[model samples]
Every structure is written in C-alpha cells, then in structure tokens.
Target: MLTVLPAINWLSVLVAFVLYFGLGAFWYLFLFPKPYRISLGRSANEPQSGNPLYIVGPAVCSLIITLTSAVLLYALNVTSYGAATLFAAVVGGGYLVTNTVNIAINPNIPRPFLYGLITGSYHFVGLLLISLLLVAMR
Candidate 1:
C-alpha cells in the first residue's frame, strides 16, 4: 500500500472538497437551473425556500463519500500526484455531465434505465478519479 504524507493528503482533500462544492454550485445555479425549473414545471419567479435537511443531508453524504474514497485509495496502494489530477477531472467532469443530463431530461415518466445510467456513470467516474488520486499518492 502507498503511504501518503499526512500534510499533503490533507491538502489534497481540502482541494477536492472545494472543487466538488464549487462545481455543484455552478451546476445548480447556472447550468441546470433552467432545466430543473422546466422539469418541475415551476415558474422562475416562484419562491423556493431552502430546506435545512436537504442541504445538511447532502453535505454529510458528500463528506462521507470523499473520506471513504480516500481511505479506499490508500488501502488499495494507489497514491500519486497524477492520480489526484485525474480524479478531479474524471469524477468532477462526470458529475457536471450527469447533472446537465438530469436537468435536460426532467422526465415525467418512470425511467429506471435513465436514472441508473446517470447514477452509475457518476459513481464510476468519481471512483475512478478517487482511485487514481490514491494510487498516485503512493
């Protein structure tokens, strides 16, 4: 297994968190908002209250996901600098695409296939990036 220096790994983790959140904010606020509104058939002027649970729940989940991926990458003996860059590109980029598609489709009909496609694609790309980062650190 690759042993990553604590300081470097922590820094990388911080970068990852910031990047993910920033991308998410961008996607929601600019990229997907139109599709989301259209999908829900909601007017742009409607008052939408932010739900604490919704915000907190996703934040907690994202933290767990990042930590779990980091641990697994370490355990799997994959830690390198290149891996970090790759992970950021692939995983982060994948989420960007997935969100775009989800907003574009905004399907009214039950579509398990579509849902699975988006979810699976996002997870796969994210894990790939995470794994690459772990491996590179080693």
Candidate 2:
C-alpha cells in the first residue's frame, strides 16, 4: 500500500477527475439536456430544483470513482495503453455500467433503458479516459 501510494501520479489523478466531472457537466447540461429530462418523464424546459446536492453529490461521486480507478491502476501495475483500455472496459462495463443499468431498472426512472444508456455511457467514457491517462502518466 505504501509503495503504491507513492507510485501514483497525484496530478494526473486530479486532471482525470476534472475531466470526468467536466464531461458530466457538459453531457447532462448541454449534450443530453432534453433526453435526460425526458428519461425522468419531465418536460424539456422544466426547471430543476436549485439544490446543492444536485451538484455536490455528483462531484463527490466522480472524485471517488477517479480516486478508485487511480488506485486500481497503480495496484494492478497497468503499464500500457492496451492494458488500460482493457481495464476500462472491464471495470467500466462490468461494474459501473452494469450497476447504473440495474439502478435505472426501477419504477422511478420512467425511461429506464435510455437513462441507463446515457448515464452508463458517461461513466464508461470517463473511465476509459481516466484509465488511459493514469497509465500514460505512470
């Protein structure tokens, strides 16, 4: 654990976290604004509650995901681009995406599949980029 901690490029992890969080901002706010709302059975122009949790919660979650990915990359000694990509696919798809889809498969989410696809895709892409960055920086 001590060896792995020093080996991690902290700056790269910060950058990856920023990229992942920023991508989510762009994704939900700009790219799929309407679709995301529709998935919740809300109108496109419906005003969202100005709740701080809406912003802070996701940021915290993204940070956690980024840190976890960084630790995993270091612990597993992923040293190449191919390995990074494979790591992304397996972790992103197997865990993140699958859990996201499972969460979406609930009565609350009106368009369960669409919501899962959009949200899961975001996590997958973020993981892909973050994993690659971690490997490159390592």
Predicted model with the maximum lDDT: 2
TM-score of 2: 0.95
RMSD of 1: 6.2
Query: Model 2: residues >4 Å from true position, as ranges?
Result: 1-3
Question: lDDT scores for all predictions?
Answer: 0.53, 0.92
TM-score for candidate 1, residues paired by index: 0.53
Estimate the lDDT of model 2. Answer: 0.92
TM-score of each: 0.53, 0.95
